[model samples]
Target: MAAATPGLIGAARAQSARKTFVFVSGAFCGGWIWRPVSDRLEQGGHKVYAPSLTGLADRSHLLTKDINLDTHIADVVNLIKWESLENVCLVAWSYAGFVGSGALESVGDRVSSVVWLDAFVPTDGQRVADLAFEGFRKAIQMAADKGEAGVHGLAKIPPIVVAERDRAFAESKVTPHPVGTYLQPIKVSGALQKVAKKTYIRLPEFPQPHFDKALADCKGDKSWTTFELPDIGHMAMLDAPDRVSELILQAA
Candidate 1:
C-alpha cells in the first residue's frame, strides 16, 4: 500500500499542475457574459475569473466620463496584483482588447499568454476610436447628439455586427462601458513588443482583410499564432462554447 500511495499522490499532483487560471475581459460586457464559458472551464478542472469593468454589469451606476482606457487597464492590473495570479492566460474579446493590451503592458511577466478574440491589435499611438467601424462611429455620434453625457451614454450593440442570439444575450446582460476608454489613445512601445506569446483567434465571418494580413505577417516570426474558427461567428464563446473551451484548453 505504501507504493500505491505514492502513485496516487503523483496522479493528484499532475492533475493540479494541469490547472490553468484564465482571466477573460469582455468587450462592452460584464463578467456575467462569461458564465457559460467559466462553467465549462471549471468543469474541466481549470480556474477562470471574468471581471466586470467599472460602469459595467451591476456597476453601471459607477459610470462616469472620467473613466478612460487607463482606468480599465488599471482595474485588471490591480486584480492580478491583488490575487497574485502568475502565469495567467489572459483572453480579451472585442473592445476589451484595448484594455487587455494595456494590462499586458503593466504585467507582461506575470502573463503566460495573451489571446485576442475577434479583437483589435492596436499599434503604437492608436486609440480604440481609431478602430471603430463607420456605423459604430455614427451610432455613438447619434447618441452624443441626444445630450447624453459620459461614456455609458453610448449604449448600443448592433445585432447585425454580433450574432443574433448572442446579441440578445448581450442586450439582456449589457451595461454601459466608459466612452473615454474608447476615446483615449493607447501608447505602445518596445515593452509591449517583448510579450512572451501572442495569439489571435479569428472569427471567419468578420471581413477584416487588413487584420488578416497583419496577423499573417506575424505568423512566421514565432511570436504569434493565428487560429481561425470557421464555424463560429464573432462571439465564438457564446456561439460555440465547447469548441472555444477546447481551443483555450489546448492553448493553456
Candidate 2:
C-alpha cells in the first residue's frame, strides 16, 4: 500500500524566534530524507539546511572507494563554514552521529547545540561498524561478497528495516553508502564539548543497543535533555515529524 503523504498531526505551535538548523541524514540517505522535518521547521519560522554527503542521495554520482567517514564529515563542516552560519543547531539522524559529531570538531563554536535523533554518539576513535550487533556485521559482509553491495563495501538497504508504506520511497530515493564511512574510525577533536547544550532522543521500537549507553549518559547529565518515543521507530522524522521537530526546537 502506498503511504499517505505525511504532515504535522495538528496545527503548528506558535512561531518562536528563528533558529538555524543543519540536519545530517543517516547512511544511504541524502539530505532528501530530511525534507519532512525540515519543511515543518521552516514553516515554524526556522532556518534549515540539509546537505547530502559526498556519495549519497543526489551525490551518488560521486561515489568512490576513497570516500570514508572523514570525507562525509568534511561535507557538513564545509557547508557551515561556507555559509557562515552561527548559533546553529546540528541535528543528526541514525548513522550520522559519526559523521555529524566529527564535523562539529572544527566548528563546534558555531554550533549552539546538538540533537542526536537516535544517532550513534561515538566516543573518540570509535567506528560505528564496530558497535553493531555481531550478526548484523556478518550479513553486511556477505552482501559485499555477493556484490549485492558496492565493491568498496557500500551496503544495500536491508528490507526488514523499511516499512511497507515507506518501501517505495526508500527503494527509489536511497543510495548506497560508503563502506569506508562505516569502517573508518571517527576522529574526535573534543570540540563537541564546546557546544553548551545537547539532547539525545531515543526511539524505543528500534532498539539500538549502541545507543543504549548514550541514552543513559544523556539522562544523567544535567545539561542535556533526553526523550523517548516508544511508538516510533528509527526513522522518527518520517513517522513523527512534529514530535521530532518539537524536540529539535526545544534542544535549540
Candidate 3:
C-alpha cells in the first residue's frame, strides 16, 4: 500500500523545522572560505549562509582606516535583520567571533545559538587588539613599518609569521583584513547573558589558555557547551571541512 500524504507531509515539516546556519568568517576571509562546509551542510539537507565581513576577500575595497569592530558587527546584524532570520545558529571563526558577539548583542533574541570556532570571546568592553598575542602585535607593527597603508598593512601578512603548510594554504586564499577592525574596541553589554545557548569549538593547534579561562568563568552557566577538535587548526573548516561539518551538525 502507498504511504499516506499526511505522513510525508509530517516528515517535510520536521526537516523544515531545522534552523538555518549563518557563518560569519574571520578577518582576511570571505564567504568563499566556507564553501567546503557549506557544501557538506547542503548535502545534509540544511541551508547555510556565509557572509564575508568588511575588508576581506572580494570585499577588500570596503576596507578603510575608518572601518572598525562596530562596523563589522553592524554588517552581520544588518544581514540578520534584513533577511528577517529568526532562531539563527551563528557560527563565527577567528576574528569574526568578536564581530559575531557584537552582532549577537544587537540581535540577541534573533540568535538561537552561537558557535565560536577557535575564535576570540571578548568581554563587555574589549578590542580585538587586546586579544592578539604579543608576537601577533609585533607582526602588525612590522607590517605597518613597511609602509602598508589603511591601518591593517594588508600586503605584509605573508612573511610576518611562521605558519604550517595547511594554515598557510588557507590564509593564502584570502585578502588582507582591515586594521581598523582590529584597533576598535568591541562593546558588548548584556547580550551574551541573554543568548539561550553558546558553544566553543576549540582547535588543538592553537593555544587555549585564554579561551580556557573565559570558558571556566562561564562554566555551569547552563547555557554553554565546549568541544575540542584536536586535529583541527584555526581554520578548521578549510583544513578539516568534514570534521567541522560534523561538529556543526552535532551542535545544531
Candidate 4:
C-alpha cells in the first residue's frame, strides 16, 4: 500500500472543492459588474462565469423590442447547457432574480444552489413590473412610449454606493437595459425553491422596500438562508467583493 503525496493530495482536494459560479447581472448593467467577485472566486480555483445578457453591455447591439424575459432566460440556460456546467452556484443580482428564477425552470437540476443578491424573488407568472416600484414602472413605460428598445438613465441613480474612483468606470460601462425583459411575465415552476441551497442577501444601506421585503420574506422561509450586509449598498459585489465572494462560497 502507498500513501498519496502532499502535492497529489492537494490537487485532489482542490478538484473536489472546485465549483461553477454563474453570476447574472441586474438591469442597466452587464457581466462587468461581477468582475470583482468573479475574480476572487476564480482565484480560489473555482470556475466563474459572468455573462452579459442580451441587449446589455457587450450585447447592446442586439437590443430590440423583441428581447423578452424568455430571451434572457435562454441566454442563461444555453450558457449552462453549452458550458456543460453541473452542480452550479447561481448568483443573481438586482433585476436578474427574475431572470435567474426563470432560468431555473430549464436548468434547475444543474444548479446546486441559488443566491439572490439584493435582487427580486418572484413567484410564477410574475413580471418585473409586478414587483418594481412605481418610479421603475414609469421608467419602463416611458421607454416604451419613446419607441426605444431600452430604458436609459436608470443607472444614473444607483441604490448602491460607488466609490469615487470606481464611479466613472462603472458609469461608463452601464448600458440601457431592454424594456421587453421587464414587461414579460417570468414563468417559473418553483424550480428555484427546489434547489438544495437557497439564499437571499440584502444590501440595505439604501432604502429599497422591495429588497427589504424580499429579505424579510426569505427570513420566514425555513428553506432559505438570509443575510444582511448593511454596511454596503445595493451593489455589494462592487462595494464589498470579498464579503460577497465569501457569502457565495458559504452558500455553495
Candidate rank order under TM-score: 4, 1, 2, 3
Candidate 1 per-residue lDDT over residues 17-56, each given as its tens digit: 6644545556567778767788998886777878888777
Query: By TM-score, how accurate is candidate 3?
Result: 0.85
Estimate the TM-score for candidate 2: 0.85
TM-score for each model = 0.86, 0.85, 0.85, 0.95
Point out the higher-scoring one by TM-score: 1 or 4.
4
Ten residues in a row with the worst lDDT in model 4? 154-163
Clashes of 3: 0
Q: Mind giving the per-residue lDDT tens digits that candidate 3 earns over 63-151? A: 66667778788889899999999888899887887888889877888888788877777887787767777776776566555645344
lDDT of 3: 0.74
Clashes of each: 1, 0, 0, 0
Tens digit of per-residue lDDT, candidate 2, span 1-252? 965443432223333367999999987788887888899989877899999998887898898767888898899999999999998999998889888889888888899899988878888888876887777577556645564423222234333344456657766887777666766788887676567998889887776777888889888888778998887767677767788888898899
The Cα error of candidate 3 at residue 207, in Å, is 1.9
TM-score of model 4 relative to the true fold?
0.95
Best by lDDT: 4
